[model samples]
Structures are given as structure tokens and as C-alpha cells.
Target: MIRFFTTIGGFLLGSLLITLLLIFALNPSFLAKQVLSYGAKSFGVPSTNKVDKFLDQTIIDGAIDSPLALTYLGLDSLNFLTGHKSKLGDYSLEKSESDYEENLKQLNYLSRFNQNDMPEGNYNLQIKRFSLDNDIRGYESFRYHSSPVTQFFGAHLSLVEFLTDQHKVNNERDIQFYFDRINEVPRVIDEIIGFLDKRAESGIYSPEFVYIKAMGQIDTLSTGRIEEHPLYETLEKKIDEINLSKNKRENYLGDTKDLIREVFIPAYRRLFNTLESQSKNAREMVGVWGLPNGNDYYKHRLRIYTTTDYSADEIHNIGLKMVSEIQNEIRSILESEGYDISRPLPELYEVLNSEERFYYEDSDEGREQILADYTKIQNEAMKKMPDYFNELPKSEVIVKRVPVYSEQSAAGGYYQSPALDGSRPGVFYANLYDIRATKKFGMPALSFHEAIPGHHFQNALNIENSTQTLWKKFGYGTSAYGEGWALYAERLAIEIGLVEDPYELIGSLQSELFRAVRLVIDTGMHSKEWTRERAIDYMIKNVGSEESEAISEVERYIVWPGQACAYMIGRIKIMELREKARNELGDDFDIKDFHSAVLMNGSLPLTVLESVIEDYIAESKT
Candidate 1:
């Protein structure tokens, strides 16, 4: 879940000029205007060449400097902006340091623009300004020892997932780019190892448990046969689909196998060895509190993740209170569902977990059925979106399984936004690693959160809304805003009658309860020094999550620090603002309009979102 840090470096004088232009001026709004102008080059709204050229300069510069960003955005058609030379990113420490300097230059330039010059109520500028400010703040902190590679999502697996889920191999050029990337894998590994070594020198080491999990991930990638490797297998499958001649296909396949065997496998072996060496000295300590200046580092993490000033004690108390209330609600639901609740809640959960109907068979058919059911839930939820939202996204979202290699450490489910041009559909990857973990009752809330009215809705709307610049759509977002909306979407589904089944309603509450539990356990571990086992035990006891699921969740928080706190914290803040708006606007308040105000500007920090809601309330009163 770590956002890849961006950096700037020294280049030749001519390249520096272009890099400065790219850094100081790039914005998505500018690109939208260009696309609009190009579509109506002749007659419709006349273009202002002077204004257009200025914006185009930013787009061109960004496209050149950050080819990977364009690739991630699925912008192959715009390759001419970068001369169609496809390339991956430079992950070395040297490049990172240079990029940091470049970010400072960009920030310096952005500071010159006065908000007054922009259109009235343009929070987009506010978003960009805040984003640059945050970037600078993080860079200055220099807490590079923070876990960069974890079992969750480090370079080790991201490369594999990127190629399988993202990198398109449509034809010869695309395939060639794929091959070029294969050779770059070793360089990325070495860069990561170098960073890790630097961190170890600073007495920074991930917990022993993390090394154990990550080592398993590395083994999964490096243990298989050359031809059977996921990197080789997935790419080979894609190449077969291409209309290449048999000879060309064989050449590509042979080249890929050789690269995997000679370079990729050996690189992974090196990584495995490095991690194993590091693990010998790894401590059993779980929280950031155990690291050097760890207390201060955790405080910084809280600011970034929750975008709030809530203290660890305050968050811990909030989680405790929310957990109690949710448990009561769940008890009432169970009583209504004909379960005797006189027994302790944990005992009652055993009955719920034992229900075979609530899970699928443990086989390939079960995995396929899970994906199909998620799609069905998304469709059903889409039918109710108009009642609660006036601005639904046009882009489609598909459901897929998390790749086997990463699912062992991945979250239950997550969403990826669609490409800017809509060539690639948004994807919701559900972790079906174990059938028992994918409970049937939780399907609706899970689907709604990761697919429609959740990520798919919030993210696609951001991308589709050309008025909100690329910064707001892509760059300027927080877990609080993005995840908060998704969690809130779960509640919206219930209020709008999308979740009518009593079991489904219970499922939604359980999902929410899990988030609430995070607030407590995350704070207790990081701030209060709760053991990892204690945190896991609390989740299993309270949220009724499987033992293995709870373990994975705890390890995730250990690596991520304060991120688990964001979901509940953000959700609570948004819900509070909604209530305030409803009370102030009274009969004039429209749920649909309130939602539009929150969503249409794309995601924002809780504080900024509160301001936006206040503005909406005042506008409604008048």
C-alpha cells in the first residue's frame, strides 16, 4: 500500500530545461483541454492557441520525464509525446535522491501561483498546493528506513503483478517493451537490496515475522522451473494471443526464458539471500515504537494516513467504543435471525462460522464462483446508484482474482482505477487464496466497496471528470479520502436498500466492525506496545475473522504503521459532516446532492472535505 516515492535528478543542460517545464507545469486539467480542442479542431468552441500551448508544455514535459506514469495510466496513444520510447522507472537510490531535488524545484515553482487567480471555489488548486506541501514534508523527514519492501507489495511482486494485470502485450512493440522490462528486473532488485542495506546500517530492520512472510513470497517466485515461472508463463500466454509468426513467437519466448533463467532467477536468489541474512538479526518486536526515533516516525505516519491530529490514545478509545456498539448491533441482528444470543458473542460466532452455506467449495470452481458473484453484486448495486448519486461514472469495473503469488499477503480485496482514455477497465482484485476466507455473507459489502459505489465509483468519477486536474484525480489523494468514501459507500448501500437480506446486512456490519477493530489494535500495537499476537487475538475474538486472516492483517499493520487507522477515522469524519449538513439544511437537504458535493470534487483530506461540506450547507440554506 506504500505509494512509490518520486524523485528528480541532474541531467544535461538541455534536458534540465525540459525537465523543469515537465515538473513545474504538469496537470491533468491541461491534458483534458488539449483532448477537447483536438476533438473539435475545426468548428466547435474555438481554441486559444496561446493558453493551450502553455498547458500542453506541462503535459509534454510530464509525459517525457515519467514514462511509467503514462504507462500506468494506459496512455499508449500519447507515446508520441515521449517519442514512443517505452521504458520502466529508475528505482536506484541515486535516481531517488535526484528526484527528491526535482520535487523541491517543482514545489518552489507551484508556490508562485495565487489561489485568487484561479476560478472561484476551485478547490482543485487547494488540493494541488496541499499535495506539494505534503510531498515536501515527507521528503524532509528522511525516514528512509520505513519498510519499502514487504510481503504486501514490494518491488519483488509488483513487477510480476504489473506485467500480469497491467502491462499489455498487444503487438511487437508492446512485446518488445515487455522483454525490455524483463531485463530491468535484476536492476530493480539490486536497487532495493542496496536500500535495504542502507536501512540495516541505520539499525532499521523489519520485524522477524515480516521477513518470514516475505521470504515465503520470494521462494514462491524463485522456486519454480524456468518455463513454469509466472513471469515467463503469463507473458508467454499473452504473446501467443498476438498475431506474430511462429518463428517470431519462438524467438520472443526463448529470449524471455533465457532472461528469466539467467538474470531474473539469479536476482531473486540474491534478494532471498539478502533477506535471509537480514532476518538473522531481525527482532521479534512488532511496532514502530521499537525502532530508532520510532515514536516520532509513527506520529508522522498518523498525519500522512489519517490526515488528522488525533492522538493514539484518542484513536484507541474511539475504536473501543465503536467495537462495543457494533457488537451490540450484531447481537440484536443474530437474535432476530433466530440465533440464541444469551450465550457469549464469541461462542455465538462459532455457529456463524460453521455454516457451510456461507462459503464456497475449496476448489477452482469456488474461485470462479466468487468472482462471478462479485460481478453480480456490483450489477445489483449499480441499479440503485441513481437513487443516492447523481454523478455515476461511465467507465466499467471488472472483478478478478488476486494473482496467486501475492494473494498470500494481499488485502481481502482492492480496486485499481481504469486508464484515463478508458482503454483499460478498472479492476477489483479479490483475494481468493483460501475459500473459507471468502465468506458468502460478506460478498455484497466487499463488492460494493471495491467495485461500484465504492472504489470503482469514486476513482472512475475522478478520472472521468475532466474538470478536476490529474493531480486531484491521480496524484492528490489520501487513504482517508479514498478509503473513507469506500467505507461510507458500504453504509450508503444499506440505506438505499441495496442490502436487504438480514445476512447481507450483518455482513456489512462485520466488515465495518473489522475497520473499527483496526483503529484499536493499530493504536494499541504501535502506540501502546501491544504484541502482534495480542492484536491478532483481539481481531479474531471481536471481528470473528479467521485466525490466518487476522495474522495477515496484523502483519500488514506492522509494516504499514498507521494506515489501518485511516478507514474508520475517515469514515467517521465523513459521516459526522453529513449529519451536520442534514441538520443545518433540514428539509432542503438532498442525500443525492450531499453525495455529489462530497464526491464530485474527487477525494480530499477530512479537513478539506469538512470545508467543502460547510460550503454546500451554506449554499443550500440560501
Candidate 2:
């Protein structure tokens, strides 16, 4: 009887072990393959064992939440919720550090990986990954923790601000999300305050002016009667828009009102208290140059933004040279129009501004007309694209006004990312806040920069790339490459004869000159101890932008540091590489093929881009 029972137990144990082995053998490799397949699906590329190994290592390295990676994966919303909450001046240093460490590990892994054994396409993807990791790590070492500029700026005009402005009031779920976010604001504010406090202790506080400007925005956002609060308006409107049962709707409305009464007002009050406290202690200096190791911080910013080791002095010198060259070109154009060459550049800008032919008045009709004209311009430009680009974006493009409330602080124009599913069109937001700023003369080049063959082209192509991972499709595109491509696109328009009018040509040159000035002024304020006034003044003298515009641009450079330098530096590298290809391939070189080579990979660091182009040149030659 004892032997019979022992035999039965042994049989059961052996069967269980065999089952476990089968599960391990069948599922483990399949799980690994699924993970690789998911990455491949995200990038619209095919799966391979090499990609599987890379994906496995990515999971092991734990950089799934890196900002660039998250952006690339169409998981920006998730990343924002987890890593960045929507609150004025709120940022989390602890999270940033964690992200940094993970990114560094991933980068190190990529660096050590055997790239020689990988396919060139896979290696290209790896290079982009490394570039993104390097950029994030560079920012981590700099003044990234010093202030929350995006939040501070967004507090003035962001999606939330837009919702508020639209008076979105009716949906119960909408109200709840509103109140939920509102209740969360104070906690977010506390986190931000904690970050600022640490920076202050380390002598890394923002200029007093920034806090003053921020406080004004806060007051503007929160000053209305409680019922009239922007937050309340947004809750009310959004709630009304959603279809729900009457009973559920009423209950949600009541709960939302109660939450607003009990939670939101107090959250704003807490945020106000924090900002008011910081305002008192804020320093007067307007630039990061005041901080310890500030110069080094600025230099690091330049390197990261430009993806180059060019010094502030080198950029500054380049700006001076370009200013003279652009001026000469402008003079030649003005002379062709019978204007005196001896006249100042500012005078040319003045003439351009005052001419009735150059502007539409600030009326709704005028705005519509401008939009129509921009559309017309884009249509005309699209007809000429085969002259340059071999490939085009699958996504459609539209021109729209920057929403009224946010237009004040928004740039002249910006491209909204296309939907991952391609349900929505890529939008080029033209800031018509000050119609004069959107002068008619600037439309052609501006259209080229923001719409057709500019951001819309490059960014949409990235999203539509079927040969890359969702991460590669969305992730590793750098600002230098992206913005540089747009800036270069502006030049491409000139090359394609899109800018027919000399004034339009001047506008193109002016835009290029603006980027050149940024290279100088960004480096100057951050690395050379140039004051805000000096940077602004230099811009006015050289770039011919309005004083107000110049000041805003200068202030942006102060907070953003190296980002401004990406445009020209990136454009120069691309143009240089194209010229190299043009020279090497000579009769064999196809302009369309050259463009395809540059843009087909989406955005890459200048160094990686050079390699891709070199390969293209070699392949084309053969």
C-alpha cells in the first residue's frame, strides 16, 4: 500500500514538471517574438531576430518611458499623465532623474551592441536611438531641472487653456476630469515648488521677470468670479457636449460643481501662494548666465540643440557674416526695385510693413483671406514639389489660426503632430494674433516653412514611414533635424522658384537671417554673459524683426538656451551634404533621390545623417 501511494505521487509530480517545461518551451520564445513584433508594428517595419534581441535589451534596459521614445510610440498622452501632469510650473526632478538613468543605460547598451552585424537599416535605427538618448542625457546634465518653461508658458495658452476659452461646461465625465485635474493641481504645484526650491538652493532660479510674467498669467487665468472661472466654464461646456442620461448628467454636474467649490479654488490658491512666495525671492537677472556653471550649461545646450560642437564664438561669428551677406542680398533686391542700397535694413522692414500691398488689416475677413491666400500658396507650392522631393507625406495638411487665447505667446507658426491612425490632418497653426506679424510678404516663405514641404512634410512622413518601428517613426527625430529640415525647406522653395516676388525673396532671407541671429544670440546670452537687452538689441539691428518680437525671441532663447541654434546648424549640414552628393554624383545625382535620402529616414543627428547620405551617394553612383 505504501509503494502504491508513493508511485502515484511520483507520477503526478513528473506530469506537473513536464507541463511546466512545455509551457516554458512554447511560450518564452513566443513572448519574445511578440514583443519584437509589437515594436515592428509600431514602426511599420518588418520583424527580425536582430530586432527581437534589441527589443529584449530595450525592455531589460528599461527606457520605455524616455520622453523621445514615448513621443515616438504615440504614447505622449500616457507619458504626460505619468511623467508630466498639466499644471503651471509643475515638474518632477525625481522622475527626470529616473528617466535619465534609464536612458543612459539604454544608450550604453546601444553603444556596446554589435552594429557591424546588423542590417544598415537596423543600424540606422540604432544610431537614431543613440542620438535621442544622447540628447536627453545632455539636457539632464544641463539646466533642465531649473524651471518648467513649457508649463509656465502653457499656463498662458495650452489645450487646457483652449478648453477653458471655449467655455466647455456640460458633460459629467468632463466635469469630473476637470475637477480631478483641478484637485491634482495643488499637489502638482507642490512638486513644482519643491523643484524650484532645490534649484534656488543651488542658485539656479529663473529671472525675476519670468516669475512676474508667470504670476500675471496665473492672475489672468484665475481672476474671474468662481462661477465664471475658466475652469468652470470649460467644465460646464464640455459636460453639455457629451450625450448622457439625464440622471447621470445631473448627478455629474452636481458633483463637478461641488468638486470645483471644494477642491479647485483651493488648489489655485495653493499654487498662488507658492508663486507669490517665489516671486519675492526671485532674482532680477533675466538670463541663465547668472547661475553657477551657467556658461557650461549654455554650451551644453548649444551642443545638444545644434548636434554640433561649434562654439558660441563660432556661431556668433557666423551670424555676423550671414547678416552682412543677407543684407547684401536684400540690398540687391531693393536696388532692383529702385530703392537706395545705402538705406538701413530696418528701413527695408519698415517699407515692407507700411506698404498696403504687404499686409491685411486685423479683421476676421482679413484673417480668412490670409488663410485662403496661404492655402492658394500651398496648392501652388505642391505643384512644384516634384522639382525637389522624391517622396511626399501621405497625411493631408491644413492651415489654421492659432486659437485666439494662446496665439499671444505661441510662435509665428508651429506644426501639430499628425494622428497616429491618420484620422486627423496635420495642422500648421499660423499665429494671426497680430496680423501685421503675419504680413503678406512673409506668407510665401512662412507657408513653405510651416506647411507644404516644411514641418507638415517631414513630421507627417515620419508618422507615415512603413519601414520603421512606431518608436523610430515617432521617437528619434531631433529638433535639429526637424527644425533644420523646415528651415532648409524654406530655402528649397527659393531653389524651386516658389518665391516669385523679390519682397517674398527678402522675406525668405529675413527668415534665414532670423535663424542665423538665433545662433549668435542664443549662444551669446547663455554662454557669453550677454544681457537680455544686448541680445534683443543685436537681433533688432541685424534681423529686422520688431522690437517686441525680438524681445520675445530673446527671452525664449534665455529659457530654452540651445534650441534656437538647431535651425541653421541643421540646414547647413543638410545643404552641405546635398552639395557633396550633388558634386559626387554629378550627372548621376537625382535631386529627387537626394531629397529622398535626406528625408526618408525621418530626423537623425547630423553625424548619422551624413552617413546615410554617404551611403545613398555610393549606392546611387554604383
Candidate 1 residue lDDT tens string, 482-530: 8898999999888888888888888999999999999999999999999
**What residue runs in model 1 are displaced by over 4 Å at the alpha carbon?**
1-63, 80-86, 110-119, 124-126
lDDT of the candidates, in the order given? 0.80, 0.69
What are the per-residue Cα lDDT tens digits for candidate 2 across 408-509? 556788777676656557888787877777767788888898888999888887777786544445445577888899999999899878888888898898
Worst 10 residues of 1 by lDDT: 40-49
| Highest TM-score against the true fold, candidate | 1
TM-score between candidate 2 and the true structure? 0.83
Give the TM-scores of the predictions, in the order they appear.
Answer: 0.89, 0.83
Q: Which residue pairs come into collision in candidate 1?
A: 7-99, 7-100, 8-98, 8-99, 8-100, 9-98, 28-470
